[model samples]
Target: MKTELIITTYNNPKALNLVFCALQDQSRMPDRIAIADDGSGPETKAVLEKYQSYLPLRHVWHPDTGFGKNEILNKTIASSDADLLIFIDGDCLASAGFIERHIELAKPNAFSTGSVVRMNAQTSQNLTEEDITSKRVFDAQWLRQNGNIKGLSDSLKAGKASQSVSRILDRLSPVKITWSGGNASTSRSQLIAVNGFDETMRYGGEDKELGSRLLNAGVKGQFLRYSAPLLHIDHPRGYVDPEIVKTNRAKIEETRKMRRRWADHGLDRHISA
Candidate 1:
């Protein structure tokens, strides 16, 4: 299947740069890469320009409209022509086989959800483009030497038992596997069938709401936690507000109760002439 990688970002150019660098070593490269920019400054653009020559990239930006991630992502999703879409956060660096694993596990009428290993601020800060390109960022020994205390459990080291472990965990884990935008994949058709993400949602639970709708539409979610692990760079979420979280939670609950399949205020409303 033809695939596109869509990364959401605000201003963190450094983290985004590392993400792009990691993509350079993907076992299966995406047909295209899109930045779902939420009114970031010029520094982010400069980072994108630096990698334009190396990757098939595009930038989809909207004005600074307070936490419009869902909207920006909808626009980015619409802009892509690939049959399959893989979503990841700009703050997360892809594992060497990230793209390959996602593609390998892609199934019709089902979306794959992956896990992320959190890296401390110091580890995130010290990482260089060379480290990412060389795939050392995923090295457990290097990560441990550089302040990563979370060992094998959260490590991205894929082993021969990885697939079996992922399946076992998926079946046994109590955690509800939802569509995590940080590291997830679905076909463009399935995404549009549910009208993409709910624009009314601000931040929290927005991605989950979309997953709920997909489930309502008969698209099951498969967990790929062990196979497609991503390295999440630690950063403060200054934009998070309790009121917004409460509001989004209410909306998600409403979606769940109604079993809504398509969002009223989603991608269709943002389509350009």
Candidate 2:
């Protein structure tokens, strides 16, 4: 299958650079890396240009529209012809086996969801390209000694030993299987069946809402929380609004009540019949 990695980014070039550095070391590289850019400036463009040689990139950008992540995402999805679409946030650093793991677990009628180890500002700022290239930054012990560890859970998550535990936990874990924006994968057919993401949604619950629609369409979720780990580079979210989040939550509820499969305003408009 033609696999593509869809990374969502805004104006943060610094973190996006780090993300590129990590992708440079992927054990299994995607056929294409699509940047679902949400109206970023030149700095982000520069970052994308820098990694063009290192990564197979498809930069999909819109104008400086406010809070149009879903809209841009719809455009990106509609533009892509890849069979499998794996998603990650631009701030998240992929492990070497990240893409490999996603492919290993890919199944028909299902999407894979993974979790992240949140890096603190101190750790995030202190990271260098060398740290990522050498893969020392992925080590739980190295992080605890040189940087900050959120808790024991963070340590457990960062450890490579967690792979064995992840298989068990994936089946035993009680957490609801939702499409986490930080890390997730689904087939293009599955996404198109649900008509892609809802353009009306804001940031909060937008990813999960799409997951719910996929579920309504009889697509299941596969948990890979511990198996496919990512180091999330922490950054300030100035766009977050409590009222907007509440409104987004209500939209998700409406989708649930209706058990809707197709998005009212999504990829359909962008795709030619």
Candidate 3:
């Protein structure tokens, strides 16, 4: 299947650069890459332009309005023509076999969600491009020493192990499979079937709502938490609004109660245009 990667970004150029470096080291590269830019400044654009020659990049940008990640995501989804679409945030760096694992695990009428080892500010700031290219950043020991290894699960996720080990851990894991915007993959057709992400949503629980809609549409969820680990570069959450989160939670609850499938203000408008 033709695969495309959709990376969502705002003004964080440094983190995005690291993400690009990690993608350059992927075992299986996507056919195309789409950047869902949400009103970023020139610094982010400069980073995109700099990597244009090195990667298959297509920037889908909008004006510097308020938070509109889902809107930009919908626009990017509308523009993409790939069979499979992988989603990630700009602050997360993919492991060496990330793309390959996603492709190997891809299925019809289902979506795959993975996990991330969130780095502390020190780790995120000190990481060099060489660390990413050499993949030393993913080493469990290195993460423990230089970065913050939160728990045993984070170490297990980053460890270089056999596919069977990862799969075993995945099965044993109690975390439910959900649409993790930072590390997830799904069929483009399945996304279109649910009319893509809800534009009315803010940050929190927005991705989960989309996954709920997919379930309502008879699409299943797959777990890739142990198999496809990402190094999530941590940043401040100044934009997080408690009221918005509460509202999004209510929206998600309503979606579950009503078994909602299609998004009311989603991809159809862009696709039709």
Candidate 4:
């Protein structure tokens, strides 16, 4: 099955650049890519143009909603056209085979989640050969464009060995959740089933809520083992605004409670904290 990438972004051109680079690296590229731009500038547009020819790119913009990027993500996801949708943050980069793995298991009515490796913003902004070699960051410029994945951990190298005995014994999985916000995939039907994400969700908690709905629907999510990995650039360790975070957390808790109710009533919501 073919796939589509639905990436959400605002004014962050650098992150979008990295993400686009990663998308280029996929072994089997998507039929199309939908970018939900929340009022970016000419710089962002310029960067996107560089990759337009590589993949069919579709971009839509909403009047700046003033909130975080979650609402725009929902809108983008809703607007995308593909049987399989792979979602990633603008600041994160997926491994070369990430999309291939996600497409391999995408179900008509199930959501699949994968793992995220965080990189400090310093590493993200000023990435170097060391970072890519050490597996500290995902260098889209290198990994996506240049086929570079050197200097990764021995464990990762061991896990990804193409023709080693390690490949045989490495069947064990490392993904803990069937769904995570940073890197995940789902079918259009499964996402539309829950009416997409709660557009009202402020941010910071949309993944858990949507994942709950998947469980309630009895959707089977197959973790990509170690095959589907995402490198996340750390940004300030979450929200610093106490009030904003407090409010969002309260909403997040409410979302969790709602999922629990779904479980209690007639859903199979199962996501671990």
Winner by lDDT: 3
Q: Taking the tens digit of each residue's C-alpha lDDT, what string does model 2 give over 26-105?
A: 88999999999999999999998898888999899999779888888889989999999999999999989999999999
State the lDDT of candidate 4 residue by residue for 1-273, as single tens digits: 657888777777777777776666678778888887877778888878887887789886777746546566666765666778888777777666777777876766667776655554455667643444354344334343333333443235323445234233224545345457777888876766665665555555556666766775667666643556677655554434566556756755665566641323111121112
Candidate 2 versus truth, CA RMSD in Å, comes to 1.3
Q: Clash pairs of candidate 3?
A: none
Question: Which should have the higher TM-score, number 1 or number 3?
Answer: 3
- Candidate 4 global CA lDDT score: 0.63
The number of residue pairs in model 1 that clash at the backbone is 0
TM-score of model 1 (CA atoms):
0.93
- Candidate structures ordered by lDDT, highest first: 3, 2, 1, 4
Candidate 3 residues lying further than 4 Å off, grouped into runs, are none
> After superposing candidate 1, which stretches have Cα over 4 Å from the reference?
149-152, 156-172
Q: Model 4, 51: alpha-carbon shift in Å?
A: 1.4
Question: For model 3, how does the per-residue alpha-carbon lDDT over 1-273 read when each residue is reduced to its tens digit?
Answer: 999999999999999999999898888999999999999999999999889999999999999689899999999999998999999999999988899999998999989999899899988888889988887888889999875688888887887566799988877789876788889999999999999999999889899999999989989998888899888998999999999999999999999899999999999878964
Whole-model lDDT for model 2 versus the true structure? Answer: 0.88
Each model's lDDT = 0.85, 0.88, 0.91, 0.63
Tell me the TM-score of each prediction against the true structure: 0.93, 0.96, 0.97, 0.75
Higher-ranked by lDDT: 3 or 4 = 3
Q: Pick the winner on TM-score between candidates 2 and 4.
A: 2
Candidates 2 and 3 compared by lDDT, better number: 3
Clashes of each: 0, 0, 0, 5
